[model samples]
Target: MYDIVIVGAGPAGATLARLIGSKYKVLLIDKRDMENENPKKIKNKCCGGLLAPDAQKMIAQLGLGIPKDILVNPQLFAVRTLDLNNNLERLYQRFYFNMDRDKFDQWLISIIPNEVDKRLNAYFKSFTEISGGYEISYIYNGQEILAKTKIIVGADGASSKIRKLIAEDISSPEKYISIQEWYECTEYTPYFTAIFDEEISDFYSWVIPKDNYLLLGSALRPREDTWNKYNLLKAKLIKLGFTFENKFKTEGAYINRPKRGSQLYGGKDNIALVGEAAGAISPSSAEGISYALKSSLYLAQSLEEGIDGFLDRYNQRIKGIRLNLLIKNLKSPAMYNPFLRQLAMKSGLQSIR
Candidate 1:
């Protein structure tokens, strides 16, 4: 039996394994195969791949550095905010890095200790509580496999199978249907764009610039007319004079959002949830990398102290983070109003001056 069984090899799972694998018998399972024969067959994370400064700080705190090759655009230094409702545009300078989402995930997985048992192309099917540990059932290469562990970690993404089996009191977290369009960036732009259009999304849409490509994406609240909303966003981009040099493709995925009163890091019967599985994504910005990395770190540190009452300690630690995010979430809807947007812009410009 393993000490811990992590049910996803994405950033959260990989970072958790890297932190505690040396001391524990860890098994990391994922549906993605980084070494797949066909490159196109690899997993599509369906992310804008923008790493905010806070995420970079946490990565450094963890004693890790993003390799140069993984960086698609390292000089992203500004964000262009488009208030489509008022036909107003403003520029705000912020430091962020654009990356290849898949490559960034691969880099995270690569740093994991070789001693950690990593199972790729494995589909987690179910979970059960056994005598002294938990039993996890998964399918590997068409055959079923069962593994037992003292602790189970749900580092899985938004639609987490582990969370479904483990978290009984908590309902499924709030989720958004994110759609993205990719195109060749003929002209290299050094800044990303944020589009605020309440007519399309209650949250917002975005246009991200990379060294070689441009990505336009938006998240909707799980509507049937997602495509229609995307089309409208596309028309808005065209109106804003965004030129596409060679339309590559479009993709979509589900992203979790933090909900008020949600238990971000808690578990029952030796199973703990972290990352998106625990609703760690920021409610206002939908940024997850910083929260994901930090959540996993919190869990690792707590577990190192003692597995007994670990979830309690983890929950206590994340209380401040949850509160801060909830406060921002409450104010986000106000940002969509033209008057508030203009006022905030004026206030910001005055502060800078």
Candidate 2:
């Protein structure tokens, strides 16, 4: 029996496991094997991999250390926004890190103590409510193992099995599908750039600079035709003075709107959800690494403080942030519009102060 059984070993699961490993018996399960660094093994995620300024603070609070090699000092010189005609409009905000998702996940998992049992290549089979809590069944190396636990956490990505099993009543809002391609540039740029296209109304392309590569991707609108958004964006990049020497990889995923309520703590009993499973990604930027880290820390804190107190504090802390972003999104739908995205970018730059 485990105190908490966390499904999925991404940023959220790994972080939570590390935080609670010392005091509680935690079982972290993932479909992938231990040290599985291949992005293609699972669904390739489309992300800029930009960590916000507050990410470091949250990481330290969780008592986890980031590995040195995975860190890229993307001292952002400027963020340039271009119109449909490739006209530069705004440039602001400097300094942010560019991280490789696989490397980042590896580093996060490395900090966890051995006491926390890590079950790799374990596919969650099903669950049933036991007398006190629940019994989770999974297949590991073709054998089934039933682990009884008092608490279960769904740190799984957007499509969470634990969430489906537990939060059957909770609903997820419409999701925006996004596509990304990582290109190894022949020449490196000093700044990060976002190009807005009037055609792709709700979507935008981003070029994040790393040591010797550029992370480029497009966030597609819900109903829009995604037929050739990647190729279109690649062509646009070439137009914007980016020479793509090698196409390293491409990935895509769905991002839920920010207005969706917390999908973390569900049921009146002992089940909890964190990270994308809980819909923690920011709707505006579709960035989730920071939120995953932050939410895991908060979940750990809540566990330490007892259930009731944790619920109250977690709701209070996250409600305002979600509400504010949702309201902002509703008031200015064009904030996502290509033409008006520059203004939104400018606003973000101003808020950095």
Candidate 3:
């Protein structure tokens, strides 16, 4: 029997395995095959892959080292308001680093120990409560394997099967969907820019700089009109000097918004949910990697203290982070207004003195 069984070998599962593998027997499972090396084979993740400064700090604290080359240092920039008259105003103060998500996730998994039982191409079928822990059934290599685990962690993406097994009373929200496309560029700039419209009502587009390419994406409320809005934004971008010489197909994914009553823990017994499986992303920014790492760290610490302590710590930490982000998002529309954007930009420039 293993101490922990983690579902989904993405950031959260890999990080947690590395964190607790030395001290405990852990099993990390993913539906994707381990032999798959092609990045395009994985699900098309809709993210600009910008890692904020705080996220960097958390990585250091967790001892999850990311290579320097994979980090894209973009010249500090801000949100630009695309006004009705086509006037542009910039909001300053926020700075971030663009990243390649595939590289980031691959690097994270690389650091984990080989001793950690990694079952790629394995799908978790179901779980049953055993006497001391839980019995996990999974399909591997066209065969089924039953493993006993003391703890089961649901690190699967937003739609988590483990979550469904654990939180019987939780409900998820349907909010905005983010679509992204990557283009290979012969030449590229070093600035990360976000183009947004105040009229479209909560829709925005971003151009994130990478080493030799640009990651372009748009976010909008889910509706039949969303595609039309995306087309309009794409046209505007092309008109405003942005060009994709070598184009790639577009990819999309949905982001859950400020939902309530999602349970993070199954019960006092053994199962816990982490990462997007628990709805940890920020509603406005859709930032979840940092939270995933943070949640894993919190879960590891909690395991060390005891079950009750773990639950308490998890609740306290997540509640504070979620509530804070909600408040900021609630105020972002006003903060991104044209006048405020200009003033903020001017103030930022002045502060450099």
- Tell me the TM-score of each prediction against the true structure: 0.94, 0.84, 0.83
Winner by TM-score: 1
Candidate 1 wrongly placed segments (more than 4 Å): 263-265, 346-353
- The model with the greater TM-score, 1 or 2, is 1
Query: Residue by residue across 204-307, what tens digits does model 3's lDDT show?
Result: 56777666677777777777588787777777778878786676667787765554434333233577777777777665566778778887787777777654
Q: How do the residues 117-151 of candidate 1 rate in per-residue lDDT, one tens digit apiece?
A: 99988988888889988888989989999999889
Q: Which stretches of candidate 3 lie over 4 Å from their true place?
A: 34-44, 72-86, 91-94, 198-203, 259-269, 306-309, 335-353
Cα deviation of 214, candidate 1, in Å: 1.0
Residue-wise lDDT of candidate 2 within 220-338, one digit each (tens)?
A: 77556675666777776687667776878777777655565553343335777777777777666566776788777777877887644455566556564466456545654555554
lDDT values for all models: 0.83, 0.71, 0.71
Q: Evaluated with lDDT, which candidate comes out highest?
A: 1
Clash pairs, model 1 backbone: none
Candidate 3 lDDT at 92 equals 43
Q: What is the lDDT of residue 192 in candidate 2?
A: 76
